[model samples]
Target: MTTDIAVPKSAQSLEPFVAAGVFEPIDIHAAGSLARLITGLEPEIILGAALAMRAVREGHVCVLVDDAYADIDLSDNAKKLPWPTPEKWRSVLTASPAVRVVEPSETVVVAPGEALVPLVFDGVRIYLDRYYDYELKLADFLLDRSGSERINVDESEIEKTLDEIYGKLTGEIDYQREAVRRALTGRLTVIAGGPGTGKTFTINRLLKASRILDGGRPRAIALAAPTGKAAARMTEALSDGEIKATTLHRLLNITPQHPARFNADNPLPFDLVVVDEASMVQLALMTQLFTALSPNASVVLVGDPSQLASVEAGAVLGDIVTATTPDPDSGSVNVALADCTVTLKRNHRFSAESGIAELSQLVDAGETEAVLSCLRAGHDDVVWIDPSNPDDTARVEQETIAAATQVVNAARNGNAEEALEKSIEHNVVCATRYGKFGVHYWTDKIQNELLNTILDCGADRPWYAGRPIMITHNDYLNNLFNGDTGLVVSQSNSAQGLDELKVIFAQDGELRRFNSSQLGEHTTWWASTIHKTQGSEFDRVVVCLPEPPARVLARELLYTGITRARAHVSVVASEAALRMAIETPALRASGLVGHLRQSE
Candidate 1:
């Protein structure tokens, strides 16, 4: 007959069995029997049965002897059991650190040279102390394998190569380099220089570096300027077919005729994008480009915020710069390549003595005029150029004609001959105009006359070769002609082109107007607005400062106008105009007199 027994929930009730040597070393078969007995005792006995089964399954112990061998010492009568002593016992517990025994009946079995205790299950294993030796040998083998497989890398050599490559790729680490690097690393880099700070040159270097790093031979890169003229400048720079650069509008496939259909879904094929003359780009247009490009692409935005005069009042680059805050998290991500900014400083085009550039730097630094003036006194040959009369169109026209004649003659006659013999270099001619309130009448007439003169003078000349002449005014259509040394008629007309010399025509307006492709080139003759000429320079300049109502000419504007001429400056204003300049609020505020006094 089969009998069933039950076990209790607590091990306290099993203490008697453990003390009686009935539960100390339980085997698989005995555990099965005990499980049956416990089922009759209580439902919770299932846990105890589970623990016993787990111990057996885990090979923690083995039952070598049964009830038949109760009177015999199991170690000595191990031959009758399935596993014999020593060798059999070692094999059984080889994988485990300890061994245990279980018996249903009260019997104590022992072997010589082994301490077998009854009712104490913890003292069963004698081989537990030897496991550490096996672990140490395994660890030493792993260490040997690791040491043999190690590779020696020359980190210093790698760093040297990187530094050399970077240095060769970029000429120097000036403010412009720092700015571009910062921008490349994902900061909004804003480069503002009056004129000829090598903005385009720096941008080209940046593009080359980015392209080399991109690995893929990208078909096209986004090249944008504020206007068509600026776009042309960028195109001229990339004479090689390797970099396919296009204006933002052309790249975006947008035109005035198709203004209603701006599609952001269709992206142009380009691995990297570079926007030159970025200041002129409207904020809305910028947003459209950002949305159109893939998130993984990289972009180089180059522009002078002060050159945003052509932009609408609300959509100015300065406004955009002011709106953007330096993100702390920028460049932290290892994968992102889209967001970066760079600011270019140091106007290589102008001499350090130029007050306009100096004053702008002061303003950018948030310094007062007095402080700016004090700084200006340390430099020599800094003069103020101002034009009186609101309607100085005639004077500007005369100055343009004279300047054109002088430049042409000077170029033909040689610099030293013109400077020493004719005293002609000193007669610098400039075009001046009224404020923004006045129509750009003088600028228009002067530009037209200049273009006509250049066309007529070289129309029959064999060297003309359709000498490209860039016009400041959009209506003039002078780009239709071709030439080597083209006249960058206006800031907007300035674009990347193969022009040996760039002649800028300036009109009194906002300073931002001059920051474009045309004006950013290495200018031969800077015929530009006094406002635009503030942070700029020229070889020879003729001032046409027109007398305006209510003394509209500021001291800074006058200072900017005069210092643009490097070797010579010709001021064509009445004595009254000069006197008004002495007392202008701009002059008083700048404390020019105090600085001059201090210098004296």
Candidate 2:
């Protein structure tokens, strides 16, 4: 199952070609070191530039606007890079959304892309500007010593208390017990764990401990998550009526009218706040959440450290949980303890023998080739469909269709004992929305070609009747949240019905109906972006890797996607494509991530 292919000419060096502080692999992006890798590939130049800029920003680098004349200045007054003489370069650079070349000042606070676009085009040497200001500020805030060591978490006390109150939870595992203990006593607590590790149950046990510590009086514990689906899950997990849950944005009501106004003067409604999936909450949002907390309030952040960081800024959850050595060199203060952090190592979600569980470990090890080899050998739960090539549009399309068809046919035939279960439990996923095996292409294929069971009204969106569907977006009114699976039993069939899909969702033991618009675009077959499925888990998963943009595939995305499945996982891709995604290391700017271990 393990074989090494010929090393690419451009990939001999382990160091990534960082342009304007953004990390990009040479073999895929600009062909290792030589800019000539883009000889005949002119169409991708503009797109490549944009991707480069985005990667840098996502890694927490500031690509601020500067004057074209002072682009290279290291001081406060910036200097711009020299303009390229090539006519093609000038034309494409001007058209990019990142650049504002027509402006008089030339560097008047433009988008981050503007600064990086020109550098990417010309193949100029990009100097690293370490944002020491923000790094120190973040470090100091996390390592605040306001009675941090004073807090005492007695494990025996917590366990005894839990058993006294929650007899059902008396036999909790060691990892869950430790997490609950930390959450009970630590002011700022983090429970870092993977899927099936009983995060919800652990949080519930903490809720029980909170009531016990508060002398049987209900504690005002507010729960919030980054997304609506996660928020809903947070609320549903706790049976206690005292706990109120919502999305972070809704809880803060952060409108333009109310700025970052989370001070002692403007106190929050609850005594404690627990945010789940804290990984997805950006630094900007986290800043507001952190500032809003009263000094007396307890904060609990729960997420997986190995998953992706926020789309906006700082790796808050991981940073807080990481063991940060006061980097005298980087102005990173040494912190002995980070508000009591614990990682649940045991996995109760996917069994140790399950293919998904194995795949997860392989991905964590960055062994893409091993995962591919294991996937190629089909099992009852896991199926691998090979394509002609990663770049062949026709082959990718056919493979996606074939895999989806197999799942559907299995469901209809009831051939496999768990076929119907798999239909509802299985989902198809991809990295991006663009290309042959993307969400739209596969969504259309499943609706019109594969199942072809529902009747379409032919409106703005063809609202089908009695068809299996998934909501792509959140609709609060209909209680139809994204990732909520349901059957489109009926619709208006009138003017009001245009662009709407009538879905009946199973809530609590009853069937509830909602006549909502295409809040979640229909795909008779199910598939979601890796980001969308972060906090969720499934029985089986199909990962479709089309010839996506090089920057889109990485260790974190592939690893996170593989970990979503509980029982089995099937990845549809060519061996070459698999190798590229696996072998290519997505390097993080050394300054962005703290080298702190998760358990620290």
Candidate 3:
């Protein structure tokens, strides 16, 4: 449908952008279905090894156990707990929740329409959602793939002024220039790069050339992000036109009432679909997008594969990069077909001399010791609290409290300079929710003592009129996203108080109103999770590194967490916790690796 594409290299660096993680190490499965719901714990579910294993392995009902049990620990339980024979395990699959001996019963009050015998029975936690495992779905999609047909574009048919784009964005680097060129030419291209490499800037230039690049075709360009805030950001970036911007889910109208119904042969309304944070797009979602897209419409996948993959299954962005990337080691596993990837090598967010910049480089290379030393070098980033003793958990908690208190005070105070420094100069981050120094603790401390919130959102969080509030979920229609920040101007609630409260978002000096239920999860508390805050940036960031009692995040998390700061960063953690986070290795879905190995 599109023209000659000199297969662009997938990654700039020779080093692998992704590492393979195993789903079902033993390649064995039955019929495949994509789009599974991998939600958090269902209030509290205590399932056992047999049931938990069945739910995850065979039943396609994934569980959300404590991260500490990264492994299900079925074997350990079998040895210690005098459970039934291993051969008889499958019986638990269909056993009723009420069946005491065979079923591992609980006295939980089931919610309407849910079969919740116990949210957590004997300490096994799981969620029950009828979603498909997209990892398996991706495998199915690849298995059905024919071969890649190299797209050839006639230069004679192309316009000559593509270089004019480079002139527009001042100081546009060679890598960016190359990426924009590829995006302009190819029908489907991946602008793969890391933080501050100017993926957004390149996309802006491309959006400007939508007409020139598409050969005078009516520009029905649509922009989408995996999350709401991202989509809102895209909407803002895209200049006024017939262009439509929305979250991928909202674009498909996939709400509770209207489930996604995409026909593979049917073409969509738009001529081009540009997706930001494409790495986060799950397999099932991608499949639907491809199936629903107009046969001739182009797709541009933009994101850094080095960051986290989709929360669901399959690293579609990385898989595509590897398949197209030229690796001597990429034999059958990393097939080269559509060379449609561009990786930005420069760091735009941080300068060379800055500690954060140096930290990012070291973390990317998986250099744990170097990162530790650099952080320990210590700057005036008073937020970087290093613990002297890992054994004393309370001390770390106190340190976190002190630092957060300082940040909250600086940010929420009426002083203009102090507020500027807090909002533009710094952000606070934590590894997980449950720890003493985690996001929950910081949010609570800020709320109970710091902000003096005036109204509750009718959701989980309270609304402070002037405090900077970051939207945690994508409510695209309402112009909210994972990173978009704004202030609460006023609260609107009906007299009965039964209805959802309407919180007006003061965005760019304009009031965009939304109901509290619609606002979803948000944090005025400033501190947030590392995972939630990805794809966003601040001038300065403070990382609250508490020793997680459970699963320690990998080094990439730290890399991403640190990179969020534009000017400075302070990490508060005991040496031991910090080391654990940095040393943890990342594993990609192997099913994707298997699919990518095929030659186009």
- Give the whole-model CA lDDT for all candidates, comma-separated: 0.39, 0.55, 0.54
lDDT at 16, model 1 = 32
Off-target runs (Cα >4 Å) in candidate 2 are: 1-137, 145-159, 162-173, 239-244, 256-264, 321-335, 376-380, 389-424, 450-461, 466-487, 491-501, 504-514, 517-525, 585-600
Q: What digit string (tens of lDDT, one per residue) describes model 2 on residues 1-600?
A: 011223234433312222222233322343333233333323324333433344345554332222111212132321122233345555665454433333221112224563432332212212122232233333444445223622445656776786675554635546676666656655667788777677777888888788887778977778898876677667766776656567787677754456644544686767778999987776557756766776656777888876777665556666555454354455553344543667777777665556666666676677877877667655555556565544544544555455555544543332332332344466667776657666766676666654344233343454444345666665654655556666554333476654334455554334566654534454443556777677666666767676533566776677777777766776776666666667654433322234232112
User: What TM-score does candidate 1 reach?
Assistant: 0.43
lDDT for 385 in candidate 1 is 31
Residue 591's lDDT in candidate 2: 27
Tens-place lDDT per residue, model 1, 304-360, is 654323222122344334323332444122111112234455577557666545644
Clashes of each: 60, 12, 27
Query: Model 3: per-residue lDDT, tens digit, 441-558?
Result: 7766655544333233333455443356777665546756556665433332457554232344434334566545666677664577777776567776767666643454666677
The order by descending lDDT is 2, 3, 1
Ranking by TM-score: 3, 2, 1
TM-score of each: 0.43, 0.66, 0.67
Measured with C-alpha atoms, the lDDT of residue 318 in candidate 1 is 41
- Superior by lDDT: candidate 1 or candidate 3: 3
Task: Between candidates 2 and 3, name the one with more favorable lDDT.
Answer: 2
